[model samples]
Target: MGASDTPPFLHDAIWQERIFNGDWIAADGGSHAIVEPATGELLGRCGAANAADVARAAGAARAAQRAWAATDYKQRAQVFRKAAALLEQHQEALATWIARETGGIMPKAQVELREALAHLHEAAAMLTQPKGQLLASQEDQFSIARRVPHGVVGVISPFNFPLILSIRSIAPALAVGNAVVHKPDLQTPISGGVIIARLFEEAGLPKGVLQVLPGGAEAGEALCANPDIAMVSFTGSTAIGRRVAEVAGRTLKKVSLELGGKNSLVVLDDADPDIAAANVAWGAYLHQGQICMAAGRILLQRGIAEAVTSRLLEKAGRLPVGDPMSGTVALGPLINVRQVQRLHAIVTDSVAAGATLLAGGSHEGQFYRPTVLTDVRPGMRCFEEELFGPVASITVFDTDEEAIALASATEGCLALGVISPSVTRALRIVNRVPCGHAHVNDQTVLAEAHAPFGGSGSSGNGGRHGGPADWDEFSQWQWLTIKSEAPQYPF
Candidate 1:
């Protein structure tokens, strides 16, 4: 179905109808139609904003920031609590929106909603946590330092995982008393725009404190470069992230980025083949493997390589591949046809370079069957690149040294996993690597609301999201001192 033939509710959704500042308002520019990748059905449309629209949104956020910041921390936390409740109440609807908009399976979409809720709850708890610190000084003097919000934050989110990524920053930024001007991806405007804006409003969040402007590079660049925006929190590809960082840096804006990953899952000798394959399959195929921390490269110790490969092939072959909206499909569509084409190109190129296509390298519409390639060597495109799809590139290594070397040679080190019979050996491998997050006897795609999230190398700039730690990313520090006596001077 064409977007013009959209369902009434989706057609009238906030993104389709208007942008948000204090209320739903029409964009001066126009609208861009959105379609479901799974069936080429018109999902809806979002505002196509230019620099002027972003400036308008930033202006509104700026005007609202002072009053919002002055509100008590408890009051802000209360609003988040209400928002959390509202999110839970609308979980089913939100999950469906995510699935439809992002081509994620319903179960995975539901998980994203749960993660958003977890983020909201985690952000609320952050308000009651200890502020900065008290510093030791002279007997008659005392010193203190505390975090302060940066007034207005520009959140530039991505198309994939729209719900969680947008909320991941939005919740924490608001909890710390900062107004936000959000620029969600044009493709995911439903879950990222109208739904989020309405939920915050219904939760009694103050007007103008949160604004949604769905658009493309123009809007994102405007938000990043706007002098009024105190900081930017972005989640997307490394290339785009670098561009965002460049613009934000010109203004010296405080920025936090969570970029792409070409993560590794190492299968060590003596590891149980069944357990390792299970973990690897989930990490590689969940959300159709569009995750930033997916297990793109599966490294196996030569001793267990054949056994593990057979097990992984068995699991991938049996894995359900179908419509994302289906209630039971294990893997879903990629976000769009372009993404489908991109993954296929990597597979074709890798095979041309002599990589063996072990199983499943074909597509039906947006659904690409989970693919596995063996004999993938270090210099191949698939080995060196981030496929960002449900394709697993396998390479065998003779020693731990060889495995670690190959893993380290990738463009990124966002996440890594090691499976070994001994926990001690697994940890040793983890210590030898330099990724953002590591797991033993687990897959690379693990994250929680309370843990610090980021990556090293080209994965992301050295910044973290989630939990109380992100407060530093959203806020600034100020030092204060008091003295009862003022007689001594070191100079």
Candidate 2:
């Protein structure tokens, strides 16, 4: 595949150009070729933005912020509703782009589209909700504290779960009347940037309200450091997220960081091994375990450790891996070969450190086999690191205290899950782990448009983005007062 062979959905001027100031324009850094992760073939070309390009985007967003903020709230909401409808009309085509570009199976791609649509609908609903609360004043006057837009919000999304992550922030920011300057990951730009720009454009969003610039670190840093941007929403690795916060903090911009996670799935002795294995497989291997909420650590109580390990091994061996576009397979290629090397190193190091590799510990090209390891101790590389791949490490624990300690050991505490026959037992374990999201008798991988989602510690800052949380993440508050007449002052 090459630029000439680009899919019809992406074969347009908009797909190759940067979107800002209501039109597609050339970037200062020329163009970069997008490669299909599964085949290593050229997918197409996308405009690459530099610092200058990011500055231009910031200026455009700032210029349009006031008018968009002044627009009627209901009308602003209609734009999102229209965008959601348009997404439904083009869901199949968009999903195909996601599958091909991200090396995700068709089912996973459909889920991303569904969640993205849900985000849009939820954002539309947010616009119609109450904006402020009235308060009683000590004097004969009325006072209120109301939410207001942050002017221009910079959105930086990652490649994994590109569509959902991007829209989760973009839709809400726009709904609350803030202009956006977006920078989608360079690896998967079309599905994340061009598609969003096109949807909003067709949905009657005014020019300059939403700017999409697909770029690398240079552009991302520029967007964060720009003086005009009042806030930044970032989703990526914790290392990069910290850098974003540092840069944006210099200017005192509100920053929302949704970073990495070393999530765990705790299997209690009272749980059925078969049921636990199913959830573990799904949570640990979905989309090749590329999700931030993936179950990287599987902590098993000693009593049921052997049973669950056996079932997990069977599940791992049966999962099919191949090119997603050519055939039906449960697991597809990772984002690139670099990721495969990193994951394989972690598995190899763990095995060397005495962790038993019960099942697959290898890969062919970008397609890594679903791997299972047992006898993994806390100090092993696999247990300590964030294995963002289709690899699960099992650590046996003798008691509930041990389980909680092992599950909460990782610095990144984004998602945690507990499986037990008794809901009370599961709740006890769930409450002990400090994570942004938790599931009882379920898997770790989960997200909803109407749920508050984020993390603490190394995972992210305390900021969250979803449902009512969106009001705080994307906007600020303003206090107002009214009186029938001027009152006497202290002076």
Candidate 3:
């Protein structure tokens, strides 16, 4: 998986070293052999950081934080603004790289790049806002309340939605004056990790302000255990997120998690079956359904169930599934062979349990076809678990009460979408769900760069991410006061 093994199309000359500390420093832990999900080829080898490497990265970021914090807010904003421009300029190549490396379709890959750039620009704007508040307090004294950076941020990003998910926190953490040590998923070092470091570097960001270490969970554990990392932001599975939170909690370190989701999309009786089906298709199958916000379960009112399922089957079958390198592909392969097997098993077991396998339930290597299932009941695993692949479960409900009950059944509450002819009707059903983000007349897979995106319960720790709200996780509050005149006390 080195230069000698990686195909020319997948190799990046700049990623010879996997550690960044003001410069691309070499760290000798071991080599993580990356695999191309689309073709199952050796993509490249990235350096896997050991505990000592993680310590060194933390030290570099700790030293850089004081200087970065002292830098003017406008200057910080400028860096991200430049970074955003650079990202825009390279959007095409970045999108292509993501498609080839991660088995993502071109259109969705482009969206990931666009959103990543938008996050940078949003952070730039957020940093420009006033940093402190003048308060009325204490007689004859002027009081000011201010926020400051936590000094260093340890970021752990997942493989899916590599660009946007990492940038969601990184851009804002930097904007608010924190140096960051990021660990992208071991599987996607080049597209997910190195590209981020290069963008900030090309923007003239100060050395040591940001460093990326590509590796597995051990590296992330090392980063979390480091005392210098004041805050840790993680986006991954709920199982792993709990581990991160537990480790960070031991030191009482600040932690933010954007974890797993098993969200649902509801198609009400009043909705247009055609539009609802299309939205469901996009929500469930986009990026091969790897997104945390993707709809794994789709609930429909009894009257519209057959109509919507017919439309969904038509749309799903019409969409092309092939090599992501092909421009005509609407869907691409799963991220890895393991995921393909897992998804196929889920669909197979559901069908055995009497759930109808509507569209596809087959694969060739990692290239899994878009799968749809209907008549799924609670006993079926496909109806309950978060099948983070190209599989969607459709359930029909006879009443509004039953629809809300079914949609709220999933353990994760990250997000949900409800479609109805009347917005009022949609809102009525959506409001009853435990979801953190509820959208009307839209898919569950919706997020804006400026939105405060996060969830409660199993999905997240109720921490706000994106926009200025992210500052809450990366900063600290301090109150300062001064009296114009000193009063003499009868001591």
Candidate 4:
């Protein structure tokens, strides 16, 4: 695919320029080319914003917030309802763009589109929910505490699953009456930023209420430090998240960081080898293992380790790897050349450290085979670090206690999966691990729009999205008091 092969929907002006103050305008920082991950082909170009552009976006969001907040709740809800309908109408085109840009297969793209639509619908439902609580007050006065928007929210989303991640924050913030300035990953500007801007625009969102800027680190840092932005919602790596926190902390701005993970899936002795292997294959290799909740490590009980490993190796060897846009393959390419190199390096380093490469350990161009390593210990690079690629490292444990210990060894625990014949046995291990999401007899890589999604420790800052958590994360409480007459006070 070349520039000429760009999707027809993306030819619109909205996809080529920065969306600022409800208008499509050129960015001060010029533009950058978007390359398709699977074919290394030129997809299109999107505007790249500079610090000045971010500042301008922040000003616009701040200016529009008051009137947006004062809009009728039903009207606010209608915007999200319209956007949700539009998402359903354009699902196929959006899914194709996701596959080409993110190197995800068609099924994965469909999943992302469905989740994004759910987010919009959830945001619409949140509009009519109770917003405050009545409280008893002394001195014959009535009092209440109500939720209020943060004025301006800065949303920074990552490349993997860009549509769902970006919309989860954008829809809720806007529905709750906060203006948003979104900065999507440069690698996926069209799917993440352009699609969102167009959806809201068609839904009749007012000018200046939402601004979309596709840029790099300079723009992200500027958005964090801007005085007008009251809150920052970021989804990326922990290293960059720390920088965002540091910058936003200077002005005491609220920051929500959803970072990286090195999640684990535990297979007990009672688990069927075939079932356990299926979970491992799906959890570890889906989307080429680029998901933040991807299962990075697999812990198997000693009695069943050999059986499960054998099945897993067979499955890994059979999975087909190819370009998602060109063929129907189980696995697709990594996002870029750098990721391919990094993933290969992690596999080689682990092999050098006594890990037995059972299935795959090499790559051709950007497509890395579904690789599996057995006898991987805690100190190995693959065990301790977040390998955002198609690699699964296995370690055998003798006891449930040992399995729990091994699962919790990593610095981040975004997700955990436990497989056992008995639900009670699975719960016992799941309760012992400290993860944001836990699954029993299921894959680690799972998410729902109505669930509170976040992590503890290095994975996130205990800030959650979805359901009631959205209200807490996007709004603040304000106390109100009412009386027939002014109360006397000492002067």
TM per prediction: 0.95, 0.97, 0.95, 0.97
Give the number of the best model, judged by lDDT: 4
Worst 10 residues of 3 by lDDT: 1-10
Task: State the C-alpha lDDT per candidate.
Answer: 0.86, 0.90, 0.85, 0.91
The lDDT of model 2 is 0.90
* Residues 1-491, model 3: lDDT tens digits: 45454433234566665566767767767778887787777766777887888998999899998999898888888899888887777776678778877888888888888889889888888776877899998778989998888889999998888888888889889988999999988887777788888889888899998989987877888998999899999998999999999998877889998888789899988899889988999999998898898998899889999999998888878888888888888888888777778888889889999999888888877777788898999879898788888887998899888988888886677889998879988888887899879899999898988888987688999887876687677788889888988879999
TM-score (C-alpha) between model 2 and the true structure? 0.97
Model 4: per-residue Cα lDDT over 1-491, one tens digit each: 33354444445544665545588899999999999988888877888999999999999889999999999999999999998888888787778888999999999899999999999999999999999999988868889999999999999999999999999999999989999999999999988989888889889999999999999999999999999999999999999999999999998999998999789999999999999999999989999999999999999999999998899899998999998976669999998899889888889999999999988888899999999999999899999989999898999999999998999887788999999989998999899899998999997998899999998789999999999999999999999999989968998
The true-versus-predicted C-alpha distance at residue 235 of model 1, in Å, is 0.7
- Least accurate 10 contiguous residues by lDDT in model 4: 1-10
| Pairs of residues clashing in candidate 2 | none
Candidate 3 or 4, higher TM-score? 4
Looking at model 4, residue 164 earns an lDDT score of: 92
Show the colliding residue pairs in model 4: none
Indicate the TM-score of model 3.
0.95
